[model samples]
Target: MVGTAARVTVAACIAFYLCRYGLDAAVMALYATFTVVALGVLARIPGSGRQRAVTTLWVLPAGTALVVLGTLLAVRTWAAVLGMLVIGFLVAYAGSAGPRIAGAAPGMQLLYILPCFPPYAPGTLDQRVYGFVLGAVLLAAAQVLILPEPVTPPFRALLADAAEAAAALADHHDGPAPERTLARARTAADRLRPSRVPPADLPASPTRAHKAMAHAAETVRTLLAQLAALHGAAAPRGGYHAETVGLLDGIAAALRQAARALRAGRRPGAEPSVAALQAGLDPVRTRRAVAALERLGVDDRLVFLRRRALVVQAADSAVVLVLATRLLLGDRGVGADRAGHAFAYARTPAWVLWWRRLSTHFTPRSVIFQNACRFALGLAAARAVAGVLDLSHGFWVLLATLTLTRTTSLETRWVVRQALIGTLIGAAAAGVLLALVEERTTVYALVLPVVMLAAFTLGPLRGPAWAQGGFTLVVATLFAQVAPVTWQLAPTRFADVLTGSVIGLACGLLAWPRGAGSELRRSMAGVCTAVADAVGRTASRVVEPSAGPADGAGIVALNRALVLAEESLAQYQSEPREETARQPDWPAVLAAGAHARRGERLLPGRPGRIGDGPVGGWLRREAGRTAEGYRALAERLRTGGPDGPRGAPTDPDAPQLLNIHGLLEVVPPPPPDTDTDRAAAAALLVDAVVWLDTLTADLRRIHGEMAEMARRAEPPGPRLA
Candidate 1:
């Protein structure tokens, strides 16, 4: 903050002196000074100095265009208000693209608001453009050349660390300290959590590479859980078969290679290790191994199936890791394969990617859309009010509205109260200063830089009140130099702020007043339903591989629903909620969605299909039960019910018809010569079992979390009355 304050002060002083004293252009001077404030204090572009400089350079053209539009619209009251509405929505909605655009949005809005005010300044448009360009160039230069911020760790490095941890955990799944390795792997996975990572470093953008990376991170966590579960299951009489052990070792090696490639900033070469692992675990080889185990008198069918399920699941996760890593390293060719469907956007046009991102948030259910609408409406109303009242310094009204409004009414009200208090105090101080130093432009000029430095430094550290008060003093001093000012200016500033605050408060109440709290529940419910549908569809496809292609619509819905849920969660965290607010386990909800989506992505690609025999029928029944369980949970969430469904079924017979031991007795093993049909069926069954097991475990965990939250939310029994 100190560094930023110094940069802003130096740049603004230079721009002000050049325009005001040297060129004697008051319009240019005012625009230039405010431009520094807008980009420096209002916007918070994050990245290395070079990145920020580039962003600033890109914003200049947009800012110039807005200035021209605002100047043209300033000729009429209605036109200005309309322009505000359109410009506000566009600026705010553009945030869906990424963090850089989002960060620069508020400052860009200011560029327009500054010009769309009284005096119908079309003739001064050139001055405004010059001032904006000069301020932007100077600020960009300062960002790069003066007190630049040190670069933080990149997201890829974090992923690489996680991959290494996963490899270690895989190698030690049955080692002496399996629990310790699992814990360490889990810790590494947690580092990639959305809440832990910086927004700029997150892979949440709309690009295909980012999406693939995000999914890969989620899959890594899933891989760890599978390894732990596999270790917990009873081992075979002679440990895992040689083939199974070899497959596990291959998975570990592939993970290590991926880690190395990511660290070295190179594409993992051709994914031969993954392909080899896949080939080694082919249906024929795996089925022969199972038959060989049966021949060796290893008759614990339950243990046999459970262990195989875990191996197949782990192998699936490894494949996704390789594919995602390749894509992240700019291997666009990976998307050509069926398994790489998740990276569909790898070769998409940039504009289409951005458009998809924006269009996805166009629904009212989206927090981004809600915020954009609320922002646009509030600014438009403020402009209209200012114009009708013919208030002096009317742009201040819009500025106040921009700064004070928040997603939730409660937060907005709190901010407005703080800002009003700060504005009142600062206005009184400004009035006294004006009375004491009348016509002393030199005194105002000397103090402006010091005030700016202090305000920019402390305002963010101290909260909204200090920021508002400091800004009030800043504008007071700045205008005093630009033109003569009296004590009356302070009262006018207060009035304009008050009016804007009222406008902001109204908009907040009228538009999504609860912020994401309500939307979160709705989105979570939608995600749960989508997950349930995807699970059912995926299970069907596994049981019946020819079951038409994958349910693309269902997959897309699940993705969209998860995106909305995540956005809502982000917004909810930022809003002010009541202490007594009862919320579900949000992280668990997100995990459930991710797990379901991962299954949908990987399960259908498994070789072979289960015929409509007893095992296939049993698998379909279990999948139906799992889907029903999720739907029931979704209903509870939608209706705001406290208690969730009971924990997942733990009975041995619950997962299969007549239990695995009984099925083994009834179903004969394949002959020494591998039958392609039997081999395929065996492989599909193993994949299905693992998918269902993992899905149920995740559901059980989420249910337990929800039930715990409900128990806490429940009112105590009359306090021993």
Candidate 2:
């Protein structure tokens, strides 16, 4: 990281010289880059589509660097803020759109890429805007040509892990060692880092690459799903061919790309590549997904042995409500989003909430309202300074302080607290460094490398709050170099930052109005939906003991829902609102989610040890066979060609996993819990329709609450009127 930072310093300087600004400009720009990269890395915490967007939003780093650099160098503020907003919007646009459009795995890129640049740049507001536009373009180009490559790296490691997982299932079923095989596979997968060593040596054709990646995904998914099924036994008979599934599905997506490429008459290598890897299998991350038809446990399935075909047909009723009511509403930003907002609001705190709310309310004059209500106040203040004011940098700095400075997680809050401390320390260090060099050439050289070190150390190191503070200080001191802050201007420059920060807070509050209650309601709804979806998926799909995929898919979805729920709980805790919360049995909602998680194997809970006798052996054999079937399927998928991957001609020894309906069902009373273990196992049983029913109830309840509020606010419903 230090070496990288050193490289960053040099590059920043070159950009500075080429871009022509102050030394402080260079340092601040680098700071933004470091922040963006760090945040992108951190956004991996877990939450909503917007949380993913926030994580992926890259403009913060790039734009911030530009604005700060410009501010110290005498660039106008307006340009800085404008650049920040435009790029911020673009960043948001890209981050949000990417996941909805790109294949699931690649969405991880948002975490890796968004934070590599400044969210706001420094300078004359116009120049800052220009800087931002340039930086955004650079980032876009980098992502198009470079970003996808990194996203694919994690999966390659994942691919290898899947292979090992398959091998583990194989050996376990074959009565050899299971733990050792699984351990090795786990370790191998852990090492795949998209940050440094991405996946290697592939064909030039993106379609081919996509195909390889897709195949890799299928192999991993199927194998992991199967491995999860196998308890521990060595089965002799063959099972579903897994390698074939992974390979074929992977190739299918690649072939789709290939077809497009071939029709376009482009050379394989020369084809205009949208992705570094060909897009692969449709991610069956949904609750009760069809993809898990192979990975359900028979016993687990039997528990939910009644219901089949869980369909979630949500017809966007909110649209009708939106059109009908004069006051339109949609649950676009759920409560999870509200907490996610807190993470972004670290720079300015609850102002994050305000901005989100204000943006929605001022839709008719959204842009104009934002500019006038948010900026005009700040602009008026800027004009007070001089007609030659720099509003752009000020604007974005304010914006980031509003949107990006979040405290959603303890870690996130800690990150900011550390950064602030770092900034203070940095101010002092910079003062010391400034005193020593007296604004000389040697000072410039010395500070440049120091800034680089800060960037690098801040990348991966974690501990006490001091880490961020110290890191921030190091960069701040070096970037707040004295070359620009001559004897006469030093105090004023320092004061400007404080002023900018204050203005930023003020703008954030006024511009984008937000309320906690709405977020809470929305988030609760989402969590319920996610919970129901996960439970439903598990019950419906994970019926076959041998193929048990629904469990894993359910695990992933349930975990996501859990995260949103946890976040909601935290946000609800963070700001206590009397009216918006409680009454709705949060504990029950949480308990339901908890139940979903345990049943899905996403959380830690013992499934009870069999009496260590005949039952144990029988269970072991069953699990082993399950493992074998999963392995067989995985192997078949990885190695199989065009003929539908599995179910091919000439395989006799394979243990068939076809009869699934008998294995699982949704019964009225989940198998009688004779003992504690039985009860816990029963608790793990999925209830697809049950969760959905609960969700519908909750949604209706929330709607009623909203309706009540409306009734109270207006004259009344028909009853009162």
Candidate 3:
């Protein structure tokens, strides 16, 4: 907080000094400096020197161009208003693309809005542009030299630790926690510096290593899930047979080599082959273990338990084998290096992505586009109202409108309430200070920094209202030197802010009002849909081992959707509630997704022989049924209705898991002389049946919750008066 206060104070002093010397376009320097500092603080984008430099370079020219254009348009009120609409739409659309773009949007929008406050000539425009460039340079220097963030060591350590975790999970050792390991990896990746390493060729280059490691982490998590299933109550206390253990050992060794390659920032000269890992676990030896169990007259349940563990181990080994290969080789195949393609491969083309994003605003259903339109219209309306009232420094109203307005009605209301309260308190304090403070320099030098520091520290803690007050105090104090600091104008300024706040709120409510509650439901439904799709895909892969590993891309998508859902739900809970019902069963949705994901991982382990008889048909049928149920649950959640597919929904009350005991009756008790293949088949059938039962139960619970929420839905509240 203190550092931020010092930086702001120093920048303001420099700007004021430049302006005092009658430098041409010096005011532009002051505006640019203040704008850079304010927006940088809001975005939290200056985490690294390179990033700060890049931002400064890009924004300096961008801000200058926008300001110059807005100044030109400001010659006529109608023209300026029209220009504001175009600029607002573009800025908001850019922001909606992603977080990186979102951070820069506010600074760009501010540049466009501020220039319209005062008309400027061509000569003045030239001066302002020059001032903006100088200010940007100074800001970059302050960020890099004054407080240079340390880089390299932390990032390297995080990468190394994540790799170690992946390797350790493959080892199946009790030393490291897989969840904690992956969590650390995620945290590190999130905070990684934007700078890329040199010689970024080949598929899994250092530049793309994080993505590889992340994928590997997810694969390891799946492996752990498999391990959990095998280690459950049905499995024996004794460890896996010699052949299965050997395969795990080979996978462990392969992963260790992959970790080393990641640390060295290169793929290994000779990639570890999954074939070699599979070869270590001889099929004859694994079959012999099953034969031995049958010969010993072991109970069918015991025999089934032993074989289930082996199948799980085999499936887990296969998954780790592929993931370790991916970690070392990257997303592109081994031949990618010879192809001489250096750039990362994206699923969609750049032009197509942009076209889809921009085209959405053309439709009536595009909330973001509508919100942007509303914000622009509201700002224009505020400007008009300020002129009608003949309010002094009416740009203050427009500033408030720009800052306080948001996409949803609830948020806009909250911000307006806070801004009005803060402005009133701040304006009153300014009036009192003006009466006592004779020397303007004292307030500028001393009081300014104090208020700025308070604003920086208390604003976030107390919410938007307190922050607004701090801003008001800073503005009032700074302008006291130029304009008369009278009680009359302070009230007028407060009134301007209130007027802008009202206009912003009206626009939010009137123009395509979508509450946070609806957004949460939508996000939640999307996540549920992704989970259902993943479940179906996993089932398909299980039915055909040749179909390859459960698509890592699907799990990754589910994760991103889950994150969006959680964020939207949090925002929904924060808003004032009209409906008294509890928040939608989000945790239930998450639980169902988790169960579905784990069940999907278990599918890859079905023994090859299990595909032959009635057992095979039963296993496939159960998996298909579970997949269908998930699909129906997804639809129900999405539509907020009980219109799920017509089928026998799993009865949560009467649970029936196809255990080893029941399976023995169906499989003819795999005779004492049964071949190794039959013994393994019986065990795998039991495993599949048990997992299906578990997943079906989870889906049923989710379905029940979805039905309840749908039933409780009230008719839309009375339309806005």
Instruction: Note the Cα lDDT for every prediction shown.
Output: 0.79, 0.35, 0.56
Q: Is candidate 1 or 3 superior in TM-score?
A: 1
- Put the candidates in lDDT order, highest first: 1, 3, 2
lDDT of 3 by residue, 1-721 (tens): 4454555556555664565344534456456555655454554443355565566676666677887887798676676677787887777656544344555675567667766654445557765666556656666666666555444343334444444544544454332235655454445333332223211111121123433443344454444444443433242336555655566567666655555655665554665445556455435334544454344334532445444444445344444434444543544453232111111222324464355445533433344455567767887787677655656677778778877887678778878998898989988887777667844655554676677667766776787888788777777666664445665657877888888888889987888555455555556666667776765665555545655553355655665565456545544555564444544467777656665655554445445444435554455555656666656655545565212222222345222333434334445544343466655554444445445655666666666654454445535678987
TM-score of each: 0.90, 0.39, 0.71
lDDT of 1 by residue, 179-229 (tens): 677678778878888788776777767887787788778877777777767
Best of the two (2, 3) by lDDT:
3
Q: What is the lDDT of residue 450 in candidate 3?
A: 73
Give the Å shift of residue 309 in candidate 3.
Answer: 6.0
The whole-model C-alpha lDDT of candidate 3 against the native structure comes to 0.56
Scored by lDDT, the top model is 1
Cα lDDT, model 2, residue 640: 31
Pairs that collide, model 1: none
For candidate 3, the per-residue lDDT at 568 reads: 57
Model 1 stretches astray by more than 4 angstroms: 171-174, 177-184, 225-241, 266-273, 283-307, 347-352, 641-673, 709-721
Error of 3 at 590 (Å): 5.0
The most accurate candidate by TM-score is 1
